[model samples]
Target chain A: MSNNYNTDGDRMIDCFLNLGELMLRAGAEVNRVEDTIRRIGHAYEFERVEIFTINNMISLTVISNDGRVYTQTRRVSVAAVDLEKVARANELSRQICAHPVPLEEFKARIADIAENTRHYGKRMRYIASVVSATAFTVFFGGNWVEALISGAVSIILVTCMLFSDRLKIRPIIAILVSAFVMTMCVQGVTHFVEAATMDSIIMGNIMLLIPGLALTTSIRDVITGDTVAGLMGICDALLKAFAIAVGCVSAMLIFK
Target chain B: MTYLVQIIAAVFSAIGFSLLFNIHGRKLIITAVGGAITWGVYLIVFTQTENVFLACFVATMAIMAFAEIMARIAKTPVIILLVPMLVPMVPGGDLYRMMTNLVMDNSGQVRFYGHQLVMEVGAIAFGIIVISTAMQLILKMHAHITEQRRARH
Candidate 1:
């Protein structure tokens, strides 16, 4: 156990686990996460690599050149979708595959990503939130006034979301709180606006929180042979959607 | 006129979701166009077929193929392009209506919206499964052929 071989094996396992955790947190699909880890292990010249990954956890095993076996597992935090990070991680994985980097360099790279990852600015995020709510309102048959009002209210909801996200609140509770806040805001605003009804405004904002696309992607995951990953994703999405419904309903009832 | 508005709505909505997803630059334009393409195809097919399921299925397949091609060309993962592009197609209106009916205690309306939601979501899911599986097979077969040629050498 004192030989250099064990140290190298331990480092390799650490690097692979780091890569897997990065990809999972960046919102890469389960298939992509498993595939990237396996590819990286092969590139590093490991004898055997096996990985089982679902949305919340990744477990990996590798056999070294000298018959040393190493395994590591990581719990992924509930990720907020950040495609820029996904692209960066995808690019890093490809770079590693093309030519393996030292364990230190790989670990440094992961830390660099964590520290210096770029994000859309707060101003742009606010604008995007406003525009997204506006367009969705119109898309769902709301008129000009309703769209504008929904857009205005969305910033408040977006702010709430940002706060909850920073606080690291659980997703279900965050969504429930956000939905309740959003419905409450919409109701208060529409009362003065007169022309705009609560339904269209609420519908527009709901687009921001509903997990419709996630639900669809989960089934696709199942079809692609990632049954566990798919089921976990499905349950997570269904729960979030239900939270939104419950929050909205309870809020509406309170005011009625 | 309404169709034109819907298409434009899609483009902006895609842009918004792309921002929320932390995507920036040229890829943003790609998702924007992909959104218009998605709704445009969905409209054309839906009008002709008068079948919601078929409309969603064809629309999703078309845009997914677009996403795959764009990913290859841009050297980005397909999901980056695919998810934002697909965001506009989500049944937000239907989901809202369903919830509304539930609150109003209108069982009949809730059931109607629920069916629509399931059909739309199912069709899109099936579309993604079929096209992605097809793509995977094609890539695997190509790799196998390449290996065989190398072996011969």
Candidate 2:
């Protein structure tokens, strides 16, 4: 029994290392990144696998090997070196293999992300910048109020995630932050435009925030016969569309 | 004459923008050249006949041809060059028009215009994708030949 356990543990570590390499090759493809992460998570037999965007603004969908899926939005920061966090999650997964993990560990994990968000902040900043610029340009037409709103949201998200650097939160937090920041910036821009009745040409530019890449990539992936990868990409694209709508509606409701 | 300036600027801007976006390799030059040709064709056709569709079709063909030439010459990813050049031409304005019309709850002609708007935007995306894909195929064939040559050497 002891020997079997040792061999399994060794295999799990090897699998995770391989997954890390695959992720490096995938570049900025979110589906490829998530798929790689899922491969690692599966090696450990994790019940719930999720990659959070670092901004504490959006929590991506939860993917489980059990074929169950759920999505949520939350502020999760990476506190420090998340190897320990992964180790802890591994332990919980093992415990739950025989019995369900205590809710306390989940709570602690959430708290950890909140506590050490800064180390993850810079990693998140780049993706956020791309997204925000896309959204800002698409929705708002060089309006100061729109700029202020986007700037405020960016600052708030960065400040919130800055606490977790010490905890070494998961790198996936960056993706979440990017998505949220972009959505917020677009919404902010749209609101400012509507308020000021800006020109359509300017407002059109902000539509760059739309995940046209994801949409096209998903189509490509599906055509290329990578169904799992394609599905994840499709899910991401759909979620962003939903998020854009939500942000726009929320801004409308709040501002009005 | 002003159209000529827009064409030159578009081409130069596409190249400059690619550099600004950190896209490197021969594909960038190809994309810039392609954008210039496309712009020129559009200007010429539009000026001569004022036929928007014909001009757009000619521009698309130029872009497609340039993409193929660049991909083969540079031996790099076609998308790296194609996407940036297409950026200026994306039908963002149409999307905005559609959304505004929808928001305003315009019916009849407004609704008809909205549908047209969608088709135009989709056409831009479809055109870019199709042209790039065709270029990618040509590049793949070119790559195969180069591989064969290298093997013989």
Point to the candidate with the largest TM-score. Answer: 1
Single out the weakest 10-residue window by summed lDDT for candidate 1 chain B: B92-101
RMSD of each: 2.4, 12.9
Looking at model 2 chain B, report the run of 10 residues with the lowest lDDT sum: B16-25
Give the per-residue Cα lDDT of candidate 2 at A1.
27
Task: Write candidate 2's Cα lDDT for A178-205 as tens digits.
Answer: 3344445555566555643333323322
lDDT of each: 0.89, 0.46
- Native contacts recovered by candidate 2, as a share? 0.02
Model 1 agreement with the true structure over A1-256: per-residue lDDT tens digits:
2233335887778877887888788788999988998898888878888999999899999887678889888888867788888898888999989988877888898788766788988888889989889998888788999999999989988998889989999889989999999999999888788799988789889999999888998988988789988998899988998899998988988888
Candidate 1, residue B60: CA error in Å? 0.5
Give the Å shift of residue A175 in candidate 2: 12
Candidate 1 lDDT for residue A131: 86
For each candidate, what's the DockQ? Answer: 0.84, 0.08
- State the displacement of the C-alpha of residue A234, model 1, in Å, after optimal TM-score superposition: 0.8
lDDT of 2 by residue, B89-130 (tens): 544444445444545566664576556544533444455556
